[model samples]
Target: MQQLPSNSISLFCFFCMLLSSSYAKPRISSPAFAANSCNFPAIFNFGDSNSDTGGISAALYPINWPYGQTYFHMPAGRFSDGRLIIDFIAESFGLPYLSAYLDSVGTNFSHGANFATGGSTIRVPDRILPTNEGFGFSPFYLDIQLSQFMLFKSRSQMIRQRGGIYASLMPQEEYFSQALYTFDIGQNDFTADLFADMPIEKIYASVPDVINSFAYNVKSIYNSGGRSFWIHNTGPLGCYAFVFLYSPSAPALKDSAGCVKPYNELAQYFNLKLKEAVVQLRKAFPSAAFTYVDVYSIKYSLFKEPEKYGTSSVSHTTYGMEEVRINTTLH
Candidate 1:
């Protein structure tokens, strides 16, 4: 696939990096933590903005201020005010931050690269914006991201063999098999379908296909030497003000949390299928470790009881990445 113009691919990646330092605290006493305590040489992430370091920013335009201010003290290309979940995961593993695959200026790929972009989806959509305009859905969808990874894998090695100053930036090939492969995409697929006026039944019908596509990609990555997979289930779409407010529904249709009930139900359905997919992946890739994290439950809790989490807002509607505290018991 041809690369879209940088401006065309630019999009606003959302999601607040609200967890505290305790989220990254090591739990040595937990058997799961102890069993998986080995060092990961690198992290190769695939997703939308939820885990994007700067793929969309580098591909499209720079992420402006207020973003990265809380942590990097500058616009760091992340949608969050501070470090993202990917950053904390890197910190936990003692690995350097994963650079965006598309970033060209001053990038070091010795550790790993992020192949995620804002507005990305697991399944490629039927309609996308014209090449000259910003995309409604990212051109670098999951399949495209995988293709880029394959290309990067081979090209980085080729560049290393040439033995130039650039070679030092490439990862040693063995890192591919040992790196943690993280995913936080698929949310956009549902949102896109919803916004397109696709029938609720039709959207439900598409879930299997979406899950199958995700499985296929994971299998392909496994074939390419990836063994550790950390897949995040999609969050509650209804709780977000963007969805609930824009949706043509009465206030009565909302649940007790003031979120559109149907959207969250759809998200729950998607998560169920996703968990089933992970189970099958575990069975198929016996040697690989597939950890399916339920970020939906964690995110929904905030919306369900904002006061409980010390946040005044029930939804993440504003473009500014606000800080909201969350429990640190994430396994």
Candidate 2:
């Protein structure tokens, strides 16, 4: 895995801190806040590899090298070499790193739980066919992750109702209501379609359905007592090492930034639709605090100006891509 530059890491952490601190403030009149004024107590995350903590590792056992070398010095299930943006966000709130929901051993749920899994998509494709691009199917789609969250909520409520030792802890409603609900999904959904060689117009046509399902899921969380949300739109998929290196495109079609033009256009279109959906959601849930983050621009900055970020390299080598492809297939 390519190491994120120090400057890029700093910017990422700063953004996370801003979002966490801004959204975690208690809304005085909302039921999500307790009588005691406290910083947000927990965070519930849903997404893919970009924010995955250990769901892949917990499900597939140990992952390979270079996955966590930068910080952990060992494979800790993060797709990158060190802490993800979510990890920095947790730290900003003075909370321990959130544990993957599937992880069993040495797991602590006091802070929060991550439902993200590598390869996950907002919606599962009808059928997954192997492509030269090396993408595959993921059973842990957004709906499944949402189901897991609902299960967690149900189990916690059951424990509270039994008057168990945990009952003295924060109430289920207040805990979930005050918790920061974050989403970093939708990339794989579009990527799967692209890898399948679906036409651009067809892929564009699917955006509404995709965002509708996403909106419904958000509403479900709100009905379940969540009051604060931090939703990250899809990043620049065209700028990814695999897409830039392998996707067939004429030299004339490449953008000034050296990214495939069509792919990046699709990503921008999706982000626009997602932002619009968030606006509708804000109006729908007037009591909730919704913050939409433009992750594409942030990540693109690192890709566009690696030297400025103190990184020796930005794109991946052919050997590196092959290695990642093999490891992704193994999972």
Candidate 3:
């Protein structure tokens, strides 16, 4: 990931980068393969709400209306009013939006399956989910997601070999090795720690373990036939609307973008460590390709200048994309 030591200066550079190009593309870790050269047959995603295509909604209760209304014209399990980044990624590859592995009804896993769920964390939370209480955290943490992927990989092939109508929906065995494995988790780990009333120092101290757990899962996927990895670092937690409402800070404690200063700093620190972990992964698995996308910088830029991105305000909840307008012709 690119370093952004100072929010002000980094944001200025971000603006310049945006102006220089029509689309603000992600920085790729490797340049050996050009975009057109990649012919990804499928995309297997593992992450939290940021990349979740409806795992939580399907596993638990369905996401209520207005969530997928913008793009899907109804509640299509996504937490957004429109499609997510993952949806666009799938479309870019000429593949359909991934079916949630947890969803049983009308699912076709021929292309790929998504193991992501809302509120997922890199580490296990103090309170495991599947409770009678309302939503808090997901039981399908990164490790759990990994387990589901393993099972899906095995069971999918088993069913496909049976040679029935159902088997047609399953992906070809070769897809697993050639697919692009995507990740967009870890934000919830920090948020969960903060909500549990843990001190900032303690949260900072736990960074190593968090990154280690994430690395462990990535390696496991690599072992499970995943070769190409596209990992997204956590976004700007400080700019989240929930943070402003729940963890109010003085004007002096706010950044130029009006986000809580300390929280954004913590996010940047997490991203830095995550980037380092990706570097280590590359060294260990020389045959595999790892692409680290600095989503935090991109999201922060939008929050810093909402008008530039078609959003009138960044005060809306980060989990929802109701404010961000997408052109019908383009989307």
Candidate 4:
């Protein structure tokens, strides 16, 4: 064979190196926490305003006030006073603040993406706004989040160049599955429609459908080779402002300590069923690393001992939105 030019050979080698680097796995950042050692390349957060960075802080919509005031000093689109647990988790991953999936497309997929939204629930029809107007985050489901993650992966060398268009949706036994997927949702369905005075039998009738929908969401990700997952249990709903504001009978339903027991009790039942589902999922997909993130206990602690966690002022609603102050007997 004829000898090739030295410059030509060098160019070919450089091209090959570039190609290899482009197809590498997504990168996760390290957290500053002393104890947390989680290394997630990207965090796919799917849930409500608690973990919402800006899902409710949109400019066009008539959103809530003081929702994220404490943290950003002026509603930086969060539904809390400060950084959420998911935000802290992302930091532990050594990543910058994860953006809402509704944001831009020029972001770096190599760093992972967030798919959380405010007022979002696992149910397809999230819930009716208090106006009885309509559902919020319509057509936005857990599947939408998975689809966005797939898009993020495709834009990166993680799958696009190597596997093909539907690579993320396909099995990845030959590759390292490092993406950290979290599903922290399902509170809206209860608060918006399934609450007491709404007919327990109606809720009972819909429970199976909701469970099946959630299972389908998990299975979709599973089929797409999502091996690492964190499913958050539903937070206590009885203590939330949604029920506190709308229903005057709420305080009457509370147990000692002024915490609503029946509402919390129902939440507990839903959470238990979710936990059981996760257990069955683990058995079905032994290769997957699945863990439950406890939102019930976390929210409970914050509610029961707001002084302990400094979140007593976390309560707010349309009626007493401003009147609601962050006060504690201990505080």
Please list all clashing residue pairs in model 4, or write none if there are none: 28-41, 29-93, 29-94, 30-93, 30-94, 31-92, 54-77, 71-81, 313-326
Could you give candidate 4's per-residue lDDT for residues 150-207 as a string of tens digits?
Answer: 6754455455457755444332332225566777777666665643377655664666
TM-score of 3: 0.86
Off by over 4 Å in 3: 1-26, 33-36, 130-135, 250-252, 318-331
Ranking by TM-score: 3, 1, 2, 4
- What is candidate 1's lDDT per residue for 6-79, written digit by digit as tens? 54221110011112212431111111211133467778999987877888888876878767765698988777
Ten residues in sequence with the least summed lDDT for candidate 2: 322-331
Between candidates 1 and 3, name the one with more favorable TM-score: 3
**Candidate No. with top lDDT:** 3
TM-scores of the candidates are 0.82, 0.80, 0.86, 0.72
C-alpha RMSD of candidate 2: 8.0
Q: Which candidate is the best by TM-score?
A: 3
Q: Please give the distance, in angstroms, between residue 315's alpha carbon in candidate 3 and its true position after superposition.
A: 4.4
Candidate 1: deviation at residue 238, Å? Answer: 0.4
Tens digit of per-residue lDDT, candidate 3, span 66-178 = 57766798888776777888898787667889999999898999999999998788899755566554336788999999999999999999999998899989999999988
Better of 2 and 3 by TM-score: 3
- CA lDDT, every prediction? 0.73, 0.71, 0.76, 0.57
Name model 1 segments beyond 4 Å from true: 1-37, 127-135, 314-331
For all candidates, the clash counts are: 0, 0, 1, 9
**Residue 104 error, candidate 3, Å:** 0.4
Give candidate 2's TM-score.
0.80
